[model samples]
Target: MTREPRSGCPIASTLDIVGDRWTLVILRDLLNGKSRFSQFLSSPERITTNILTDRLVAMESAGLVTKSPYQARPQRFEYKLTRRGEALLPILQEMCLWANAHIPGTWTPPVSFMARKPE
Candidate 1:
């Protein structure tokens, strides 16, 4: 179920889905090719397991990701970006560039990430 956007403003509507503190960080991880639950946990932001679970479920519901069983014994899954998700790549890329340009002490994003365009 989609939440009502706060207004008709395009950016506000977009933020309605991706505005939370962890969502963009998680998106960066996904765009960087981390798909497994454990891989997400290993990110430097150190998201708690419960919050990670919440974000993944919300993202899946928002059609940003699709998960498939990767291990059947214990039913583990790996996630992949949907086309809708891939379309957010340039947003992340621009964020990286913006931060590197304006923020002090921020790690510069890799050339691969900077150059990557939305698929």
Candidate 2:
């Protein structure tokens, strides 16, 4: 299911898929080793369940994440970033750097996080 780009502009096109309020936050959670639905819900951002569900589905469709069933009884699943998703690591790292440097109240993450490269 390929989505039509909103425009030919590179940044705008990228934003079309990941520009939503919750998507990048979800991406951050995935990078920081959160995979389960409940784990995402536990983030300090306090995303509502419906929005989380929508973001996860959109991400999966965008090839940023893959969902696999982790439980059988009630059919629960876990999400993992694909290579395409992992490629966004640097973007997130830069965002953290910008926030830490420009946003006075922002918390700086460990150096290890900044050093991470997509695998």
Candidate 3:
């Protein structure tokens, strides 16, 4: 399903880039220091490999991440958040705070994570 871009609304434009459920989860994992594909697979939600690949590509294309090859034999890579992606950390924290307040049984984010300043 394709829709015309809404250039006027900042929120809508941002959502158009990172609206998928997995994108934010992937970003959250990156913020937690998970860099490898296997590490992302270890996330509790157990995202499928295919979706992860697609999202990573989309994110890279959007300048949110950059993947550096870590192993030559299999071309293994580690993904890191770009400055733009790192800027979303506070937004994610706000979401976490909102969830903790409204959702029963929601796990509280670590104090260290909430307290740390973005690089």
Candidate 4:
């Protein structure tokens, strides 16, 4: 089944693909090089297994993430961001900077995080 576009605006069009909360969180982890399922699970945000599984599948279907098998016996999957997904880093950085400046008591991420070039 195909999903309809949320809006005609470019920003909205992009958000239609990655606006969900879990999707961004998943993307954030992937940006940090957290490729393994268990590593995503162990994040400070503590995502549930079922939700994580569903989000990963959705992202894969959306062409934002690609899943690859690392082991054959039990079949493990690792998630990595596609170029489209990696393109969100600048947006994420802007949001983080805005939150840090405008929101009270928001912990700041490292300067390196804000300055790091996308791969």
- Which model scores highest in lDDT? 2
lDDT of 1: 0.90
lDDT of 2: 0.93
lDDT of candidate 2 at residue 80, scale 0 to 100:
99
Task: Identify the superior model by lDDT, candidate 1 or candidate 3.
Answer: 3
Pairs that collide, model 1: none
Give the TM-score of each candidate.
Answer: 0.94, 0.96, 0.93, 0.89
lDDT of each structure? 0.90, 0.93, 0.92, 0.84
Task: Give the C-alpha miss distance for residue 62 in model 4, angstroms.
Answer: 1.5
Error of 3 at 33 (Å): 0.6
The list of candidate 3 runs beyond 4 A from truth reads 1-4
lDDT of 2 by residue, 1-119 (tens): 66899889999999998898999999998999999999999999999999999899999999999999999999999999999999999999999999988999998876777888999
Expressed as tens digits, the lDDT of each residue in 41-69 for candidate 1 is 99999999999999999999899999999
- lDDT tens per residue, model 3, 26-117: 99999998999999999999999999999999899888999999999989999999999999999999999999999999999988879867
Pairs of residues at least 3 apart in sequence or in different chains that clash in candidate 3: none
Q: Give the Cα error of residue 66 in candidate 2, in Å.
A: 0.4
Better of 3 and 4 by TM-score: 3
Relative to the true structure, candidate 2 has a C-alpha RMSD (angstroms) of: 0.9
